[model samples]
Target: MAQLSWAAPSAQALLAASDAVRNPDQSFGLINNLIEYRDGKQIDSSTLAVYARADRKTGQFRNLIRFVAPQRDAGKLLLKNGNDLWFFDPSSKASVRITPQQRLLGQAANGDVMTVNLAGDYDASIGAEEEIQDGERQKRASYRLDLTAKNNEVTYHRIEYWLDRNNSRPIKAKFYSNSDRLLKTAYYRHFQTSLGQERPTETVIIDGLDPKWITVMRLSDWAYREVPESWFQRDYLPRFNPEQAQ
Candidate 1:
């Protein structure tokens, strides 16, 4: 694995620069609502509400949403405390508590799918810089980053990210399998700042495994506030938080 070096402007630098520029206030908390669409039709919709107080803060997230369409009665919940991750699925009434290793694996999987930056978990290298669109307006000084997972067991081999160089925000991401085949791609269409962080408001996930199965996420009416740390505990997952269980 390659370390992000300042001398050559590594991929991490580009990402950090983007984060700093887009989120000048440096607020770390955010809440997002996501909608998943397939074949130009609405198939599923959900909300990925998130909150982050700081870089290493515990109990920094909450994902509350109903996954409807392909699966009628499915809901997924994820809570993170620093390096720990807790995943809960309402349909199965099952919860999986993840260690640091598992957390890395989960982030790796998500990093492959979404253009959203995963802070310092995986090593990334800057590939190229170009100009792209932010909505209909054209922006210059965008960077391309190559992210490779340190763990070999994960499905994705490498990911290419096109980020806005001025702000280091990702506009598009391409994932490839171990055999160098394209796996999936995500496009970020809208962005907003909450808790001083720039997060995508509209996103699309195209699955290579099943091209027909496209997942779209849209964030709206975001609210940021303090949430109980205990909400992230695996043991408490079954209880469900009334505020988060819409």
Candidate 2:
């Protein structure tokens, strides 16, 4: 992966740069507040305490997402480690395998809540250079990154990612399915200092089928913590307690 210092930037390097801007390179935790909307009205909401740490071998993140809000949904966990995704319910003491494409919030998928290094999952190429409107409604010169999934396990089969040309900050992205249909349009906004660099603090997702159906994910309380690799194992779910364990 090439850094911004490269005069002749490679597609892979530029894509990696945008990924770095979105995800921290080390173990981190944050609070995600999700609000679902329907036709401009609030419908449902949830809060998640997310912990992510990079795997030593691949340097990809392994995430532990715990629901911490709305008494009814508390104590539920979603683990995304390597290629496996599992949902564990503390009340039932059951763990079930899940796909990343499963819907979590209104327009947000299970994969959206977890940390993923896109450069590791997709093959990228620069498609075009254009000035696009950002989440804040400001026009920005960006590089259109065309991404194709390296395998079937990824969230989307195709993605048209737009990143700021100057600093590689992700501006927005259009996701497409394998059948070449639009899935969702996501806008990364509200950049704030977290764990060091400025990262998107809010993500606004619009449903491809119904534009009125929206999901807004706001991130906060970001901190670097010592996340153990053992927490990612399937057998550890029943015993894993986010409050006392890690």
Candidate 3:
């Protein structure tokens, strides 16, 4: 029952590994995400095109999401500036403040679809190590990471993250609230080469309270792109040209 304390080098390597899985590009990138929600027997899905740019100084990702599916949601936009997130509905012609905790559809939140690098927002320690079978039924040694939020900006207050000991590929994660209540569990799988790096293609999240409810986010079409500085400005939301995004 002895507790495990991670070494500084191991912790840094783990952080870098998690960041690599989340966003591989050293600077800027874009990806398409398809999200699906399931509750019992009911299922629903949405598609989004996301553009992400990293702040060289802070290492924070500035993301812009454009809904691209189900005619009704088309043209809607979500912008993330630091810790704050904003949603703009083309029909309403207004911008409203939103939080990462808010559900975008069903079980998935806005933060789940955005490009996030956990190393910047979390202070991680290796809490334990275990042997486990991955999605492909491959046995591997893995490290279970205990992560504490460095600040209030992150989506989850605390997290239990698991990653392969050899390659630093994330295997699973459990998200928790400030009160230490379990919120959800996510399994990372379907590793594919994107933007010249292999990363998880799908993240499947199951509700903590209702295990039958599940949400999935699929990432694809990753490309290294140039993101203009003007894109991160709040004033650009209204005038953000969808045509320019493509």
Q: Please provide, for model 2 over 29-75, each residue's C-alpha lDDT reduced to its tens digit, 9 standing for 90 to 100.
A: 88999999999999999999999999889988899999999889899
Question: Which candidate should be chosen as best, given lDDT against the real structure?
Answer: 2
For residues 1-61, could you state the per-residue lDDT of candidate 1 as single tens digits?
2343355566676766654533322223333444455566765454344443333342122
Best candidate (score: TM-score) = 2
Tell me the TM-score of model 3: 0.91
RMSD of each: 6.1, 3.2, 2.3
Candidate 3, RMSD to the unseen true structure: 2.3
List model 3 lDDT by residue over 1-246, tens digit each.
Answer: 234534424775687777887686654555555555555564677888888888888878888888888788999999898888989988877989888988886678888888888888898887887877775678877888889999876789999888887788988889998899999998889998887778888877888898888877778777777777787777787788888877
- lDDT over C-alpha atoms for residue 155 of model 1: 35
Which regions of candidate 2 fall more than 4 Å away from where they truly are?
1-8
List TM-score per model, in order: 0.66, 0.95, 0.91
lDDT of each: 0.53, 0.91, 0.80
Candidate 1 or 3, higher lDDT? 3
